[model samples]
Target: MISHAKIPFVVFETEPENAQRARDWNFGIHWSVPLLQDLMPPELFAKLASTRVDPHRPVQPSETLRFLNGATGIEIGAAFIPHLYRVQRSKLRALLAEGIPIQYDKAISTISYTEDGSTVAAHFEDGTTVSGTILIGADGTRSKVRNLLLGEEKAALDRLEYAALWVQAKYTAEQVKYLRSGHPLFLACCHPLGYFGWLGTHSAPDQDVPEEWVMNCYISYKEPIAEQEKCKKWPNEGNLGEVKALAELCFAEPFKSAFGWLGDEQEVWYSPLTQWDPSLPEHQWDNHSGRVTLAGDAAHPMTYQRGQGANFAIKDSLELVNHIGSFLDSETKGRKEAVRVYEQETKERAGEEVRLSYQNTEMVHVWEKVLQSPIMKHGLNPTS
Candidate 1:
């Protein structure tokens, strides 16, 4: 429902993925079924829903990675990806249609706001500067804009003792049958062993060929992120020898079998989970003038628990889109208050979500605690 026409804003995307937007929906509005149901037309919603593989579930303790009953009736996640290139390209296309300019592969080094807080300048690594009346920091987790505004010490991330290696691979019919039996998407906890994991599939770009299913998998354990970083490995990149070995070693049978599907030499993506701890440095902001702010992970980074991280991001952008006009109208004194309200609401909502997700992350890794989690129990039932 968001129309870019509302504001003549240009998007600057910097990526480890190189400006790609992902073609797969990841999991799309299915994460928040009821809420999206209210927003999207029935037909459109149904179309997205049709892409959903019902009955995502959990792994039961077994020496071989056994899956549990997927009887729980709820969708756990959703995504709306249109290929990394296509998304930005489409945005560029839209911008072109409206005569808006966009640039890519531009590394932003710092952001500076003028004296009166009336205009902001983004200094790119290429020694180029772009000025605008307002700045929305959607640069992501290690956001330069955020650090420039809040100061690195204050905006620092609080790393959890857990890390995970996630990957997507082609699912075989036999594998799908076994996985679907327990739950298409579900988690299993190794408990005392300090490990946990989840597996699920989303509709793929080339699904038409063989109706392929992409297994989205995660395996995490209690390990200090700093310890891992000391090894010169960011969360997004890891050697299979470390995290992968941990998975096979900690998980039982069926769980082991599940993870066994991971590629051997082709190192999969891995990173330690982190949350934006508002309590740290009191979660203060530097952009007091309200002319600059942030959205998405740059605004309130948290776990993808129940898909809240992504949903919160969407909500943040939507809220700004709705209130942006206030900031555009120079005479509107309420713009400051509007930004405050947005940040305040986002913080409250996302803070609790971050905390709960941190707690949830812990539960996922612990064997005993996971068995008692509402998420595991309710099986992602929308109400739960």
Candidate 2:
């Protein structure tokens, strides 16, 4: 399972009644399963929970405030309180002690399906080939296997018309103390043009540097030609001068200070927002007409707006594995039935997520309509 160790858990706080209302409105009609709740010690829960805004308090509408206007009025989205922990890679090694063969550094070149249904082969960029009974394309968004399977029908990625610039920097304890006095770690400010920005800290327990915070600045605007041009460069090797300049221009003073802390221009990471359509069909290949499938972002690359990419990927892997395990144990069904069952189940579940993710994209980028939405205004509570 993909673990969420590095990214802080973000919990938004609102009145319980309002929260329930939102739940009913947004998910009630669509979901039949009970929503998962975090069960942690009270102290840990309190520590993890940081208020984005006091929904009970009055808010002065300002041109710069960032919020998703609710059905009744404005609702705030908050970040997680910074409680950092250094990820011990050793723990990961211990978990993988079962001697599961791990592949590292070698990039997959091509995945080929034999005309008959028996073997699937993967050719690596290093001129090595590996054959396996089952082939899963865990490779991300622009999946090589997926393209090969679908031939000309591969789905195209839709740009979300936003960009995020991220950097990690050191801050003095004194500076952090001063900043935290007024603005909490989870706080964010909204702009009139539907743009929002946030700042948060990551500090490990019993650690010396509580001041060091990873700064993530997100700006929403129509995708400019220049930003699109930059995305063409290989990630981490692209020219980010123009993007950095634009971030400095759009962000406020606090964010400006945060940006200034980045000493090297090359260190900043720029990501152009893009989402995959959920309606796209899953890719399938044959073993001389046998059984192989694609899963995860290789099957469905969604916007990070809902933070469901990793979650859904893990879910896909688990579901697929369970199906395969069951099929292996069965004597009658055989490989073809197992493959069919796995594909059918995966599409049903992952497809729904893809659709929901696409809807969230519409809600965020299509702000004018979303602003007046009944769900946004009243949440789940209907006005009397």
Encode model 1's per-residue lDDT on 1-384: one tens digit a residue: 333315677777564324445433353233343443443445554444233333222222211223232222223322222211111122222322233355776778887778875788888888999998678888777777778877787777777777767665665667656654554444443435655566655433343432376666666667776676764454333455565566566655445555665556534666677778543447768555677888878877877544455556656766776667555554765667778878877777767767767776776565557655534543323221
Q: Best by lDDT, which number? A: 1
| Model 1 CA lDDT for position 91 | 29
| Residue 58 displacement (Å), model 2 | 31
Q: Estimate the TM-score of every prediction.
A: 0.72, 0.62
Runs off by more than 4 Å, candidate 2 = 1-99, 114-116, 152-156, 177-189, 202-206, 211-213, 224-227, 230-257, 260-266, 281-290, 365-384
Model 2 scores a TM of 0.62
Report how far off residue 280 is in candidate 1 (Å). 4.9
Supply the global lDDT for candidate 1. 0.57
